[model samples]
Target: MSGAPAGRAVAWLPVARPLTLVPAPPPEAAAAALGTVWPALRRALAGDAPLAVLPAGAGPADAARAVLRPDRPLEPGTDLVVVTSGSTGGGKGVLLSAAALRASAAATLGRLGGPGSWLLALPTSAVGGLQVLVRSALADREPAVLDRGEPLAAALARLPAGDRRYTALVPTQLRRYLADEPDALASFDGIVVGGAATDPALLARARAAGVRLHTSYGMSETAGGCVYDGVPLDGVGVRVAEGVELTGPVLAHGYRLDPAATGEAFADGWFRTRDAGSLAADGTLTVHGRLDDVVISGGVNVAPQAVEAALREHPSVADAVVTGRPDPEWGQRVVAGVVPAPGAVPELAELRPWVAARLGAAAAPRELHLLDSVPTLHTGKPDRRAVARLHGGDQ
Candidate 1:
């Protein structure tokens, strides 16, 4: 389980030394708590008293410690362990060495032009948020936490004007900002969006509003985003067969305390991603969706992402999530959970025809459930299982 870089000796730490598990403070306290966490995090990245950051909530802390086993010794070169449920909703500890984390940060800064100030808009518990800290630390600049209870404009104004400001956000957060404060969003030199796919329409809107948005791909296993704007970062490699596989200095060592899962995912020097994507001739990568998300509806392979993208473009639909459920006739039927546009009442009749025309009859959702908002996980991705439950009359 050693994550030691090639040619480096595996220097095992003493068993009595346990890595500290720091639970991120609530949003309001996060900015103040940074002073404490930053020092510890810097030490961890320097390979002294490595630690794991548990999520803000109580359940995540308990769950993380149960698996983290702080009293036990870690594999050689392992500096940080990030606990992620990822898109599958099952928790796993992702082991990342200091070298890997630093490489990801350096490559990201290189790709983005140069190092500068960063706004911490995402939660620290997640890899994306942690990367914000990592990049900020390496850049020798303190990050501004968005959780400081200030308006977006006020926060943006506080960032150093001399430096090229950057921030990371999920699509949901980006949408809200685009709707409420477009000017503030445009202040950043770069904005990296990841955790889930960003709708093309949304990207167009953001770009039109002068928002410099960079769509990112990768997960906690890659120490945050290894790919930005469909291009792999410096020194990172991307190959797509049945699923996306990544290899490079940025890849995580392996999962902590779970050799079986680790071996299955990281093998032959590549980490197999659950995403299904394709690499274009020009080297651009297009991620379709999760490999398991493809639905065989009416004997037709339907990609939920395509349907969801089409649904979002409709005038009456503000946001939408598509999933497949059991059906007697089709074996599996496509279902939609939609959030209607402002003051708009979206009906199944109009929506069905809209999707049918854009995609196809088989791709259209057979059932539509209108809601004020779609259910999402902590990472801001739509909770597909929860959406399925809602469609099944669970409310």
Candidate 2:
């Protein structure tokens, strides 16, 4: 890592020689970079050195030049800054302490029944993928990586067997993997899925197929996910304000060099999330959707995810993205773009009753369109802006 200082928020960048920065290498090299973060992070936490893990296409020297300043030194104990997946909007660097990472790793392992080897399938630049490295590092084990360029099944075939296999995947990846190679996915001892809200129908199918799926909730600010499978890990706390608020050892120090952004998101030791959810009396946290997810349709707040989830239940629908289109009469009309199953083209006539039966008339899509696939960001998450554009026939 170049240009990044070793101490938390110290003016190390100005005083010390321009350091090497950790380039966010391509996915092909993500697994290989797993070992690099440990020592650098250790040094950073112990001495307050700042380590910036730059995403691919950028080099270590860039982070130093971009954010390092004598006026804003990282606080003591700040270790690593992982970039957020800007799927919703712009990405930001989240600063986390060594203790936060350790707490996350320990709590995760305790929840998952001791330490085991993890497989790297998600990008190392993202917290989901980086935490895989962190967990594996803490366990003193090397994780297997499935290069992004290759087919998932082929990559799984290349993985070393004989140890308990664990991996984290976004819902899209898991759904595709389960459809393509059920046996291979079932071979894993655990599979953590996040990055977006998962449909209940999908989860049921996964469970029936014997996939140990764990849905997680948290952003980079929470050091990845402090809540796994609707339950908070040890030392993790959850509260519901306008949305969900989390306080725990896994919380990040703050956003790097962006106090205004940090102050707004983190306060009273709790990191507030954009997701709208509720906490059950038994401690189950049910995340409905993002607070910004609602679209006013005919004077009613409509959650497109709920509509999309219902659409996915159709046998002919392989995947779906639901959005609201502005209409003169309705204000916003619900529309759905569906990736049809092999040889299936869903029509609105049949799809309407299908959704209305489950989610009521208001939630039913007013229009249905066939799509080859859903538009996604590099992080393999749905590009909502682009998807919304698709509603206007922006192919």
Candidate 3:
């Protein structure tokens, strides 16, 4: 146990308590199920048996239960357990207190002006999606939940028009909305995009089309996006040592039933985010990418995200992902998987020089695979491991 502040008792770590697991309904059934889950959500937030809401791809309840281990005891004060792969692509249960979740929602609404009706476009399993519901509940309004394949216009129109309308989206969803129904996107007072980094070019396009966009950076550990538009939220703090670290009241308590992992991630009231970044003198954060995402080719270190950004700037590329592949000569080669712009087929020859100009020769992709669409997780983040396999590379 750690020492508590004056007049407060030290909260012992790893208190044992069981939690209920609520497997989220499939996308088609989610709208109808929202009403049923809302009451349970309220109870959970109020410190009833805490709930772990599983994501859709989690399969059947038995399968989810196997992975989540609902029978295992959780820490005291944990009101919600969010199962997330995060940036590492390994599943873990993040233990969030009701206070932390509420703090995050309050800070988000305060940052976006005030509380308002929200449009739930992302899956409820992820923190981003759950935060929308959490915000809506706190504001005393039901969110307009978007079913799978629902049009953005139709979804936005579902919300009551009076209060400030807001929504959260991943970069893939934002890109699609910008291309297909930018008018609908512009209707929102604010849009929070996260789950992965938003491309600079995509941000420019959305802003040009009159969309109010906030780029978010955080994970389940912070209850979802403590940083918006490079600035930390009201009480959230950002610092960089070996990697980015965030300190705030909105952070989760720790990982449920994984003390070893939790101990490594959280310490001294700060969560060590495994992302390489820098903080400007003005306190703005510029994320360099994940510390583990660097690829070394021919003794030159290359950041895949930087290469991906360069690729996206190419006129013929709609989207791109860079992964490192084992090579006998270079030790590791930078490989690219690209989704071409409509009616455009970009060649490796054209892209090689294109990226080399912006980044460097080592950063340029040695191999290119033209994909019809980038493989993405249900959370709308590009599946980097799957993207690596596109060119037969091991992730």
- Quality of model 3 by C-alpha lDDT: 0.85
By how many angstroms RMSD does model 3 differ from the true structure? 5.3
Cα lDDT tens digits for candidate 2, 144-196: 77876566667665556776678899989888887877887887788889878
Model 2 is weakest, by summed lDDT over 10 consecutive residues, at 12-21
When 2 and 3 are scored with TM-score, the better candidate is: 3
Q: In model 1, which residue pairs have backbone atoms overlapping below 3 Å?
A: none
Ranking 1 against 2 by TM-score, winner: 1
> Where in model 1 is the C-alpha error above 4 Å?
1-16, 393-395
Taking all chains together, each candidate's TM-score versus the true structure is 0.92, 0.85, 0.92
Which residue runs of candidate 3 sit more than 4 Å off their true CA positions?
1-17, 58-64, 86-89
Per-residue C-alpha lDDT of model 3 across residues 1-395, encoded as one tens digit per residue: 65667797766676566687666777887685476556667877788768877666535344446657866666778898887754456677888988998999999999999999998887777788889989998999988888888888998888997889999998888988899999999999999999898888889999999999999999989999999999999999999999999999999888867889989999999999889999999999999888888899999989888898899889999988888999999989999999999899999999999999988899989989888888876566777887776667875
Q: Clashing pairs in model 3?
A: none
How much lDDT does candidate 1 score? 0.86
Of 1 and 2, the candidate ahead on lDDT is 1
Compared with the true structure, the alpha-carbon lDDT of candidate 2 equals: 0.76
- Score residue 277 of candidate 3 by CA lDDT: 94
Worst 10 residues of 1 by lDDT: 386-395
